[model samples]
Structures are given as structure tokens and as C-alpha cells.
Target: ILAGYYILGFSIYSSILLAGLFASQTLIAYPIVNKLGIARDKAVTIAVGGTVITDTLALLLLTVIVGMATGNVDDTFWWRLGISVLVCILIIVVLFPIIAHWFFKLCSDNVSQYIFVLAMVFLGAFLAQLAGLEPIIGAFLSGLALNRLIPKTSPLMNRIEFVGNAIFIPFFLIGVGMLIDYRAFFRDWESLEVAAVMIALITVAKFIAAWLTQKSFRLSKDQRTVIFGLSSAHVAATLAAVMVGYNVILGHTPDGEPIRLLSESVLNGTILMILATCIVSTFATQRGAHNIAVKNALQTNDEEKSRPEEHILIPVANEQSVDELVGLSATIKRAKEPNGLYALHAIDNRVDDPNMEKRARKLLDGAAKTAAAGDLYLQQLLRYDVNIANAIVSTVRERNITDIVLGMHQRTPGSTALPAIPGIPGIPGTSGPGIGKMVTDVLSQSNVTTFIYSPAQPLSTIKRHLVIVPPGAEKEAGFQMWLQRIRQLARNTGAKVAFFASDATLQHIRPRRERKAPANIGFVPFDRWDDLPSLEHDLRDDDCLWFVMSRRDRVSYHPAMSRIPGYLEQVFAGYSAVLVYPVQAGATDRYL
Candidate 1:
């Protein structure tokens, strides 16, 4: 019996056809609204409202069908049915005032509209059950009452309505479809006639309602016509009604035998009607909306064909060297193309230096002037007391920055002079706050696009250099962007690209392969440090080696591997003869 019920339930509740119908209706409604001079929001509201009525109609139809199917119509004589309805009405009247008052109090702040709507729906269902009426009738009345109580613009109201449309409505449609055996309609001609009758009745009822509502509202002829067109749409509620009618109201067959009162054919026919009506309503409304929108667009006065694109903010830290700052500013200017630029500078209060603010302003002024010279609109701002990185990130989000071009200086230990290894406290030869590390860390947390300007050999002078190492898994994002830039730079300079991947990363290498280098690019896969000699031999003809450093310690051959002095010395010695290109700090680093 449970299995039988499950099968029956599944047949009545399936809603794939209903979903398809709704989708089709939405498509059709778009153009109609555009034609009707209705705003997009209004058009959507109308379409949704039209679709919603289907639910109520389905409930009403189901109630009637169930009575007939169960032979309960005879049991509940006309007088008793009338009394039941009166009792239901009485329950509603007694409960509505209390419910409305409670809802108003609960939603006084206008933040609990969703909760209120849900409360009312459930309350209605419960009350209807107590009054021996269909729960859906109560649900519908609850929705209607809540809709009247809640202001249209209330966020809570909008949220609740959206939830219903997204969740409950779809589930209800699917439930309706599952209850019906679609195949039965094909076998029974009577099912088609029943469906046709239902469709006619629904259409006539909606038409009458639309006409009456328009007359009462004193709407214009066009408005009435549009409303009428929109009112024809039906889906979710209709399906739910059909399900209840078939499964609950019209009792299923006894002893697994077919019952004439609530046949599978009726359910199938209803599903088909839902699909057809939805399609018709959608197309009609969309065509109307589209035509209206196009007409409005055409009527608008002619203006400038192209307006200047709005500027996007790009934050710059004051700590950058003059040359590094200039290069980044230049890059931003070039990338702006037709759009203007806004350069923001944040003054970190943590910096105790008295001259810090003045210095930051000076740097920003110079950068702005440089950017402006390249036809980029540049604006500068100075914010106080906040962390430099946090401030920059906040400014990017608040001001809607498009991209960030940051100049990150590598912190090396020891001597400021050339070739002197800067000693770091924890690691040998690395000292101070590493700007590259900070920038990369920031990049991981940021949504804004970042371009780290590291020093490298000048593009003009560099010839036939290999983009050393395929991108390691750890540094895929940074490496890919770097490779693409290098590829472009190589194209301009007429240079070659060489890619190398560690043996562990060999399988991960794509776009570039090991050993067999492309005409313009070369790939080498190596594991042992000793293999560098052979790789060097292959690249001996190349003028320069562009070593793409992985950000992570695993693939990074620097400070992490510094502890293994012998291995480091061997790897360093392997490229001793070649112009070794470490990740450059600025354009000068590239040129030098």
C-alpha cells in the first residue's frame, strides 16, 4: 500500500513539464512587456503575478475534483458543504485580525516580512484543516492578506516572495506533475476533452477577472489589454491544485483499480494544459514588453555617440622608489586606453616619520602628472592611521578600482651595493620586510587584479632568452600571467621562450612540453640538479635565461634552498655563463 501510494504520489508530483512551461512563458513574456512600454521591473512583476494565479486555480479545481472522485460530494450534502465553507469563513474572520495585528507588530521594523508571510501561510493551512477545508485555500488567502499588509518596496517582502518563487513554487509544480501519468492522456480521448474544458474555463475566468479588475482600477485601454495578456500565465499554483485534487480530494482507485472520478488521464491532461497556457502567456507578454522598450529607446534624443568611460581607482603605496613608481604609473596609464584613472594614496599612521604624509603626497602628485600626460585621468587621495595593505584593499573595494599595479622591491640581505647579498635575520642574505612577499600575500586575499612590477632585463636589449621553468602547481596563476606577458614581450623583441618543469611537475605541464622546444619556445623537464648542465648546454646558444620563480618554497630555488649550500652553489654555477635573469624588481632591473 505504501509502495502504491509512493507511485501515485510520484506520478502526481512530477513537474518537469511544468518547469518547461514556465520557462517558455518567461521567454514569451519578455518581448510583450518590451512592446508595452512597461519598465523591466514592472514587466517581471506582471509576469510573476500572472504565473502565481495558476496556483490558486489549481487548488480550487482540485477541491472540486476530489469531492467527485471520493463520492464525498454526496456524503457532504449541499447544506453541509455550505456550512463547512461558512465555518471556514468564520475561522478566517476571527483569526485575521489577530494575525494581522501580530504581523504588523512583528514587522514593525519592516525587517521580518519573510517570517511574517511564512507564519501567515502556515497559520492559514492549520486553520483550514481545523475548519475542514483545503489547506491550500487557507494558504492562498494567507498570501493574499500578507501581500496586502506588506509594503511593495519592503526588502523583507521581496525576499519572502523570491523564496516562494525559487523554492515552494517549483516544488509545488514538480509535485503536481509527478502525480499524473502522462501516458494515460495518449490512450484516452476523454482526457483531451477534459483538458480542453478546463483550459476554456480557466481562460474565461481569468479574462473576466482581468476585465473587472481593470474597470475597477479605471486603467487605460492599453493597460487593460496588457494586464489581460499577462493574467493568462499559469504554472506553479495550478500544478499544486491539480496534485491535491488528484491525490487528496479525489480518492485514488480502490484495490488498485482505475477510478473514473480521479483517473490518471485527468492529471496528464492538466499537465498539458499548464504547459500550453504558460507558453501562450509568456510569448504574449514578452512581445508586448519588448515592443514598448524599443519604442522608448527610439524616441530618446540623440546624444554623443561615445562618452568617456568612467575612471577606476588604483591605489599606490608611498614606499616605492621613484623609478618603480613611475613604471607602474606608466603601465596603468597605458592600460586605461579610453578610460580615465584615479590614483589613490593611503597615509599609514603607523609610520611615525613627520615627513611621511608630505612625501606620500609628493610621490602621488608626480605619479598623477605622469599618468595625466599619457591621456589618463589621475586622482590622488591620502588616508590616515590605517594599515597600508588593508587601506589599499579597502580603497580598491570602496572606489571600485579595476586593477592594481604595484611595485614590489625584493628584500635582499646585506650590502646596498650591487652583487652584495642582503642578509636576512632568519635566512642568509635576505633582510627587511620583503615587498614581493607582501605584494604576493596581498594578491592572494584581493579580488582586484594585481600586476607586480619586478626588476628584469630590458626588453629591447634582451634577445633569444628562455622563459625558464614551466609553471609549478603552486605558482600557476602568477606564472601563467608572467608567461603570457613574456610571450608578448618576446614577440615584440623577436626573442625565444624556454620552459622548464621539475620532474614532479612534469605531468602537470601543459601548453609546453619538455625537451622538444617549439620553434620560438623550448621546454625542459628536469629533476636532479646535475641535469642543469645538459639543460644549460641546450640553452647555450640563447642570450639570456628568464627564470620564472615559483612563489612557494617548494619550487623556489632561493632562501628556502639556501640551507643546502652545495646544491645551491651547483645550481648557481650551472647558469654562471648565461646572463641569469632573476625576477627583476623594476624596469631598470630589467634593463640592467
Candidate 2:
């Protein structure tokens, strides 16, 4: 802003004052970046990191400008400023994190964490003011200090975002709106002219900065747009600079007469620019994020994408089966991807048992240890909710899980009985309570591919994999995704895949094998879809059964399919079995 004004032949004081005002932007678009899931992207991170530097330097520059104009530019002034800034940095960057970590470790209660962080924010603000800099600078440094301690997916981070976006930020924006007196603009056209000129300068300068950054970083066009959008909005910092200039410096005339340095028109115009830039930033970020997501999804092949990341979630209920489930997930997971397995323990919120959380955490810890023993990375997700299935579904969506591995559940003695008439076509008397309910709910409600495994023997003892594709399973939306997973598993285990499918389904499987070239995949033709029951003859103690089933109402669903739950209990009770749900059709939006 200062450069623009100076280039336009404005007075030195006017240029410096404009520069300070421009430096104080509200960063109202940060929530938009978070929502887009690109908050960690390089462009967005650079823009955010740049804010701390820009605001700190601008505030320091404001002091210099004021000192020079007021005839206070002396050795004493420089010494005071230098000492104050160094002191503030030492406190914020060096001491704050150490204190925050100790307090967080001492406090397990979430409310205390919230209060502690809030208190620290105010403390930072106070310290910055004392150091002859804007409080926002201190606040920024405090956040940077604590960033590594708070994981983005943690509950504390969610709480912080919720409070800022849902409460304080909205109020701040409202106050900005109230500052804009439309009467001033209506009374003076000069206000409109000032607004136009300032807006043009800020917007153009921001674009150039973003453009240069993108060229240097080799960022995508959409990323460039995001950077420009995020940098354009001026709110909190801008207002602080403007109000200070208006009252302390710009308010005085050349003859030393007291007057408003920023006239009503100029103030009104600045407010209008804020509104305009905020709107632009919001839309631009949304569009750019959508584009990035689409680009990721539209890659020609899984291999073409940056080493495909696999988020495999194993929801553990029993400590007995934790190792088997974790092992299965690690074995089948894409080796090239960077992410690892997530162990989830969802306890019902209605349970009054005080030990539920502790118990859940223990089970998750066991699962994590199991993964670590195998040299695999694992994340723990412990959720307490009224509906266990609903909680798992939410986790799947939030974590962008590609596959779900669950232990096969059996009906409990006190569980509700299956509906006599059944709710949907295909299966009859197939439902049960406890683990069966959890599995059924997730399979029906979620879009991700799921694997329900019940081991009769240890998974390590398995000799062969038998994959059964019922009738129209090939027509399902996620058939390819599940097929690829089967291939990956077969490839990893060095086990030959024996695929049994109807003749029509075989047609699709052949081309996929040729295209994807899945290791050890061989198709066995079954003339009739109705003869799926006959596969029991080929089943053996050494063979793991893979039943590829569609959810109710999907293309491959069968009326007798409702009998699956009962059939497993009656015939395959002591055998290891895996029930797979392919990705649903027309559900690409959640693919990432």
C-alpha cells in the first residue's frame, strides 16, 4: 500500500499510513481454507506464515513512521524499540510453548485446556503491547509456538476452531460492519474515489505477490487463486492500523489543528473494500479447493496419482481380535502410500459406566501396539456416541477412509431378534444384535469398501484366498475399488486368488485383470448366480472365504441375500470369512 501511494506521488506520511493500514488484515478466510481440507497445502501455508511476518514488520514500520513524523526519531527511540522486540520474541517463541506443553500435560480435562489457551492469547497480547508492537503479532507467535503440540485432528483443535468461527470471529466482522456509516459515503463522492483507488492498489499488489509466489513455488493455478484470495481480505490488523492513524497521526492538520486524518468518505470506502475482498476470498477458495479435489479424483489410474494413500480403519471391539484385524489391514494396505491404519473404538454415549473411555483407550492402545510390532504406523480414534455405528460412519467420512476392516460379530443372548418380515428385499431373518448390528449399519450407511473378517484360525496360517462375486456384483459402483483391493491383498500375501463369478461378471473381470494386471488373479466361472450356495463344497480349512456382497437396493442385491447372516452362522461358523462391500455408485464426492 505504501509503495502504491508513494508511486502515485502521495506525501511520505500518507504513503506510510496507508502501508500500515494495509498490513492489518482480518484473515477472515482462514475457516474457508480449513473447510477445503487444503489448510496444510503449500500455497495456503505460505500465505498464513507470511501474515506473521507482514503484520510484525508493518507494526514496526508504523512506529518508525510515527517517530519520524513526530520528531522522536532518536538513538533512545531505536534502543527502546530493539530491546522491546527482542524481549517479546524471547517470551513468545521460547517460553510460551514450554509453559503450554507443561500445562496441557498436567490437565486432562478439555475445559482447562481451552481456558489455558485463551488465557495465553490475552497474555501474548498484553506482552506485545508492552513491547511497542501490535498485540496481534504476539498472538501470531504464540499460535506458531503451540502449533506442533496440537494435532489438527485432535478435539482441542476442533474446539478452538469452533469457538473462533462460531462466536468471536462473527462478532468481530459485525463490529467491522457497524463501523461503516453509509451516510458518510452518501454525503461525499470523494469517499467513493478513495475507496476505488485504494481497493485497486491493494487488490493488484496482492495478485502480483501471489503470482510471483506461484511462479517461484511451481504451484498450480488453483493454488495461486487460493493464495491471492487469502491475502486480499483486510480486517483486524487493517482496522487497528487505521484507527491508530486516524486518532494519533492522520488526525492532525499541517498547521497542527486537530481534525480527522481519515475523512468519513475514506473510512466508509475502506469498509466497503473489506466487504468486497472478503466475498471474493470466500468464493475463490471454495472454487479452488473443489478443483483440487476433482483433479485428484480424475487421475487416469491409481498408479498415476502421487503414490496412492490408503486410509484403512480397523474398528476394534475386542482385545482378542485386535492383532488379527491390524495384521489384515497392514497386509492389504498399499505399500507405497505414506498413511497407516487407524484403530477406532466407538463406545455408546448412553453408557453410564465411567470406565468406558478408559477401557476404550486401553483397547486402542492394544491395537496400536499390535500395529507397531508389525512395524506399521497406527492412529487411534476413540469416540463416545449414542450410536456406535453412526460414530464409525462419521469417522469414515472425516478420515476419508478407503477401506474398513472389522471383526465378524455374533449375536448376543440378550440382543434383539431379526425382524420376522425383514425391512428390505433379499435377506430374511438375517439380522442380529451387538457386533452384527454395528457391521450391518456401517455396511448399509457408508460408501467406503468394508471388510468383515472372522478368523477361525490365525490369519498367518491361511494358505489360499477364495473370492466370491455374486451375480450382478460387477454392476456395483465400487466393484473396481474392491477388486483392486483383492488384487493388492493377493499380491501382498503371495497367495493365489481363486475368483468365482457368473459368466457375465467374468467379462468385466478379464479386462480389469489385463488393465490392472493384478498378481495371481484367476477367474472360475459359475454358470448360475443362484448356485452361490454350492461354493461350500470348495471351501476348506486352509481357504479364507471372501464374499463380495452388495448393500440392499444396490444393483447386485438379491432377495435371498438377507439369508447371508443366518447362512454364515449355520454353515461357516468355524471358518474364517470376509464380507466385502464395494464402493457405492455416484458417491465420488467423498472419495478423497
Candidate 1, poorest ten consecutive residues by summed lDDT: 576-585
- At residue 35, what lDDT does model 2 achieve? 58
- Per TM-score, the best of the predicted structures is 2
Q: What is the C-alpha lDDT profile of model 1 across 75-112, one tens digit per residue?
A: 55566656776776565656664566565543433345
Error of 2 at 185 (Å): 0.6
What candidate 2 gets wrong by more than 4 Å, as runs, is: 1-10, 23-26, 249-257, 300-592
Every model's TM-score: 0.38, 0.54
lDDT leader: 2
TM-score, prediction 2: 0.54
